[model samples]
Target: MTTCGDGRLTCDEETIDTIRERVLSDVSARAPFDAVTGNEDRVSDGAVSGDARATKTDREVAVSVTSLSKRFGDGADAVTAVDDVSFDAETGSIVGLLGPNGAGKTTLIKSVLGMVLPDEGTVEIRGIDVYDRPREAYTHVDAMLEGARNDYWRLTVRENLRYFATISGVDPDSVRDRHDRLLAQLGLAEKADVPVRDLSRGMKQKVSLASVLAGGATVVFLDEPTLGLDIESSRTLQRELRRLVEEEDLTVILSSHDMDVVETVCDRVLIMSAGKIIADDTVDSLLRETGLHCVQITSTDLDAQIVSTLRGQFDTFSANAREAGYQIEVTTDSDGLYALLALLRTSDVTLGRVRTVEPDLEDVFVDLTAGDRTPGER
Candidate 1:
């Protein structure tokens, strides 16, 4: 007569602890502009906030795109990668791009970078048209498209930085002082003479970052800087990023899935689904706007009938039986939690450990992109 799965529901003590233990995070790269950032960002309670308190008074439009679109193949094989999308990225900020699989994040970023020409729409960087004026547009920009692969495996860390800077037209000699400083700041100074092939993946990633920053580009587009990085390494990268934006007067546009990077680093988030942007706002605002808070409870006598009653009374409710009792998770707004409390009081089940679960990037991501889909006749 037991249906609660024999007390097999294990508690998530991992997600239950400090922030560093949970590194993968969300998106909201609004001011803190593009992708990835450093520490020194203070997050509290159950919400994710902006990385910086910088105002708009000193900010300037860095990258602008109006009505962008892209598609792959044609007819039956056609896959609409990016729909008519448009948004502005501010100077000296990190913006995180998030989406489900097949989402047009990559296509949108590529079209903006001019790597993939948009069938329709235009992309502008620092007032230069990226599509029409590639040279003039690229002069103020640089990108680390393939993460660690962006470097030459045989080149020394310093050699890679100098070589990339020169190819990108940033005079290595003129920026030598700046280059050395960046290496030191990014914790790559000691590894400067080490061959790229000899460095760990995380070190290589940092090298890629130094190369990008060394160019003195105003805007940098990073696909996923935190990918394959460990907790400490990721934290290091995030810290260096914050320093770069603050000291270098740099602007970044990053796309990543790690919620820790997104929620902690990005100033605002742009969530794309299918081929369109579904949500755009600061992380704190987005979480608050979702209006959903969760509560976990254990009951001694919860049965199928009582579980159904609870589910009927709430939009987001789930219960599972265990040998000790019933484990229930109910997600609702403020008033709904109150209603739930009232319902529980009158029920025959003996409830225990009813506490609020802090809403984080994962919750916001699931709710916003729950049904992320394209609105075309398929």
Candidate 2:
């Protein structure tokens, strides 16, 4: 699916990947961030980690939100977007904020950035209270909000980068070097002279990222940065993001609906719903705690007896039939799929196959936020 707005095209999963392949085949960004094309060596597994280690001493807290709460209207119309949310992101780490639509993810970010003042609570950027010192707080933080409305459509990609770098206070002598480096890194070097209006959505997004980076702020906030990007473009941004965190010692707060990106990029994740922080833990920690417990069984056919047996053994289960066989799903603890296969064999049923299901971040998100009332209700 594709949606067009303000001359920008937002693509869904399949189409986005197809478009990305075409773009990379023609206009490569640069080495580190564009390795998806062919330069695999430049894609470092710990680029962000390396960057973070280099700036460990700079160790200043990047952003902190303590007991923050935001409410709109009153009585029947009341809506709380952030409910006493509090968290601290170190100077050199990538933290992801995740939630379903209307889950208060945007509200929390906006309050922290001083775009909307919370009814109660405080947001501090680099130790500067956003409410008390909005300007001062903003000075230490740079953000690429959804779609990042910063590009000069009339200017060429190169000219726009240079202009933003200059506005960001880059020294005139260093502007060209910085612009060229960014253009090459983001794969816009060849299109340096192409007007922004002519660029694809992914290209425009890269430009947005470059603009925020040019600011040299200690903390960067990216809301849904990969929402409409193809798999490869998303991967490239993740690599460069890690580079920034590991090498530049930059603190990044990313709010996105992309679980794959969150799983691969963030050091920790905060799950939000109904304006509250429901879960916060490292990616590994969440996985470990959740455990790998899924049951899979394939048989020539499933009888009502088997359905009853499965329902008795697990909280939830599903069954479906296809050409190969009938597939059954069940909740299990961290155990191999062999156990279920054994059960089928012992039952004297014609067992077709079995497999274990691995849990991903999306499962974690759905499980964690399942309790909240719909955001629309709030």
Candidate 3:
């Protein structure tokens, strides 16, 4: 039960009553519960009461950002990191925050976490206004931001877990259970007694992830989690992340430059460039919208001359060769494919094989962000 900025009193108990009053007051209002109240007896008594459920489904938005903007400095020196970005993350889903380097993905994440103040607009976490109640609103969120990684070098892995759990006010018994589970899952069981300063980069990442999840917050934010990890460690992290989402019903907001990770992990994506969210949709939807795909061609004699000729024919052509043969990849339409084959034949370049590579979320991101170049771009 709480009161909003409008000074209207609302409670979980009187929610239905409030709805009823508002509905009856509207010209478009047609009470379906009329049969139960006997207001309209045109319906039969044996029929299901109008008090039956509403036809529309409930929309429970977990994260909502409206017209959010962030700027650094003043006047001509000011730089905008986020500009009027608006979107919502539905409950129990993973949303990816993606963009080119310096595209303001990190800025937006920090803004939502209350690390940086927005110049305009609102950020709401689980129905609580972050600007109005910073501490209270963030009580529902746990974020793993860059440069926030500070592990006690003197403490053992187990000791570090215990310390963070206590600081977060979680029960000791719960911490023990969670710590053990995370240790086994993250392959840190053997390193529990070892000092954190002795751990590898990948091991530190695992520990950080465990600590953030232990916060028991409904929403979790991860930034470039797989950036420095080897293939095996990255795979393990992805597997555990999927398990957490399915079993714990955790909602994740991921910011990463790894396209493969974003494609495989996220349900939806937000593409930003120059402080603005230019595109927002499901990963598959973005792929469909761009119609971007790739074609891979293998050749026996992939000489520099052949590569240069191919590059000239197709704007997106690239080639890689090894001891066996040369591999060429081109991104274009079907008609362009025919033109590519004709050029190869005319150039006398031997083709070993050809295959079409399905476009993933990364292709959509690159295609969209390529046109928007930022000053001092990375």
**Whose lDDT is greatest here?**
1
Pull out the clashing pairs in model 2.
29-186, 29-187, 48-242, 51-246, 51-247, 52-246
User: lDDT by residue for model 2 over 1-378, one digit each (tens)?
Assistant: 655877776767578557645643333222233121221221222122233233577676778889999898899988777788899998889999988777888878888888887888877776678787676566557788867467776566765665554444333234356567667777778888887888998888888887777645568899778766677877888888898788767899998877899999999999988888888999989977875466577777667676677666544467886675578876554453455556666777885676767767776676677566574522
208-244, model 3: which lDDT tens digit per residue?
Answer: 7876776355678898777667898788888888887
**TM-score against native, each model:** 0.75, 0.75, 0.76
Clashing pairs in 3: 33-50, 33-51
The numbered model that scores best in TM-score is: 3
Give the lDDT of residue 13 in candidate 3. Answer: 38
How many clashes in candidate 1?
30
State residue 236's C-alpha deviation in candidate 2, in Å: 1.1
Q: Give the TM-score (vs. native) of candidate 3.
A: 0.76
Error of 3 at 71 (Å): 2.4
Off by over 4 Å in 1: 1-56, 300-323, 326-348, 373-378
TM-score for predicted model 2 compared with the true structure = 0.75
**Local accuracy of candidate 1 as per-residue lDDT tens digits, 291-376:** 88999998777777778888887656778888866889987778888888787777766776777787777778877776765543
Worst 10 residues of 1 by lDDT: 23-32
lDDT of 1 at 326: 83
